[model samples]
Target: MIGRFKAELFLILATVVWGGTFPVISELLSFVDAAYIVGFRFLISAVILFPFLFKGGLFLRIRQGLVDGFILGSLTFSGFYLQTVGLNYTTPARSAFITQLLLIYVLIFQVFAKRKRPTIWNVISTVILFIGAVILVDPFALEGKLNKGDIITGLSAAAFAAYIIRIDHVKSEGRMVSILFSQFVLCSVLGFTLSFVQDAPVPIFNFTSVGFILYLAIPATLFATYTMLKYQPKTTPMRASILYSLEPIFATLITILFLGIWPLKHEVIGGSIVFFAVILSEVSPLLRHTTKPEPKN
Candidate 1:
């Protein structure tokens, strides 16, 4: 089993990589339809994981892998689909802010679905995270009316929260490889189908676009997801969500470094607060410091 601190670190690194992906995808979207890139990304990852089918006792438990992969793939696809669809109706910033609601949805699921109560630190971290997300996204810049896009994106957040909860339950030794392979295959098929159905424009094939796809396939999806599956189950769902919330903050720093785009004042302030929230969650156990009872009293 993975140690808790190591798992948390791996997941945080996964989120950091995930955060840095925005610019790559944003650049690709200029010349490629969303569906095409999504399809290719999963297809490449699926191909890379194909060799794992013959290893890791995968064949012994192939059935379990299939079922769990379908469950996970479907949830992941739904989350992505909802957010993609919602983006058509809402601004990206607004949608991003709404997606952070996953932190709350995970808490609710933990309490209602798993019969686990949130620690006080979880509640505090969540509140701080939400405030930071709102400030970072600056939803006030958008229209005052509640949009359909926000509602759809909110559902996406719930789907992702559910995915997080289910993954911890289903992850097992020797099966993650097969499960990941199956998920990639399923997602590739769905992405291709969605592209066809939407009649998305043909993707431009160039060194830059191909490089972007390879980066996403190899690093963002394959490596990052591998770490997530291998490590996230060792930590609390609340902790995982809180760490993922650091994505926007990482994105801010990445932008400054690579794109030379400086953040707005709100973005900087909000990002700082969000980073602090993750720090608070991480050190919460240390803060409790409960005294031990007298021996043999």
Candidate 2:
């Protein structure tokens, strides 16, 4: 029980760290292109983890890690690339909220790919989540036109969902670090190549930019990924998803701090609804199990 609690707490902290990146990345984007930012961040991370690749027995797992890492890295790079590009076209708050659609995408993937049916509570939570997203985005305010960023952000959510599903399926034991290291290398290579091809502006290495990049590469990328990979398998998927939903809340808070503007009334309401829906999804299962009568021995 204590171990489980610690794992959950670490996962939430990792999510919070991820949430903090939205504002930092948004700020960095002003000075550097998205690909450059992604490239450097992953490059730094891969460098930090490079020594692990040479550990005595680690070579044995390289082949497996390469295959799994390629798949995971592709999904991760796609998600981050889309999210960063989408940031150019939308507010951080909206982008974060839209990305939460990943939870719904996971459900859809399970239904179709795994041939599984969602529980009634799962359906209920999904509906609530949808309504909350609609309120948060408020498409009507845009004259029925979706922002390009929102559409791209939605696609990013799907990619992230696929990533999550793949993680659940792969369950690569004892080689997670190797897998993650390979993923960093792949992302770094992809990011740098894309940056050069797109002719992204070279990032200025001022104190401010360097500080943000260090923060992102160290805490947000390395620490967060390590904790998530280490701890997530210990918890239920629904619980992890619910915890991840908190990222938008943290993102909204950071956004408010950086922008100095309070969220509009609808945003507050919609974000609250989405948060509660996530909580309900996790809670309902516990409620059902507890309410069931014990069978006579």
Please tell me which predicted candidate would have the highest TM-score against the true structure.
Answer: 2
Model 1: residues >4 Å from true position, as ranges? 1-16, 56-61, 81-100, 145-155, 227-246, 288-297
* Per-residue error (Å), model 1, residue 5: 11
Clashing pairs in 1: none
Q: Give the best candidate by lDDT.
A: 2
Shift in Å, residue 239, candidate 2: 5.5
**Worst 10 contiguous positions by lDDT, candidate 1:** 285-294
What TM-scores do the predictions have? Answer: 0.78, 0.90
Per-residue CA lDDT of model 1 for 85-106, tens digit only, reads 6655654444555576777788
Q: Which ten residues in a row have the lowest lDDT in candidate 2?
A: 55-64
Pairs of colliding residues, candidate 2: none
Query: How high is the CA lDDT of each candidate model?
Result: 0.75, 0.85
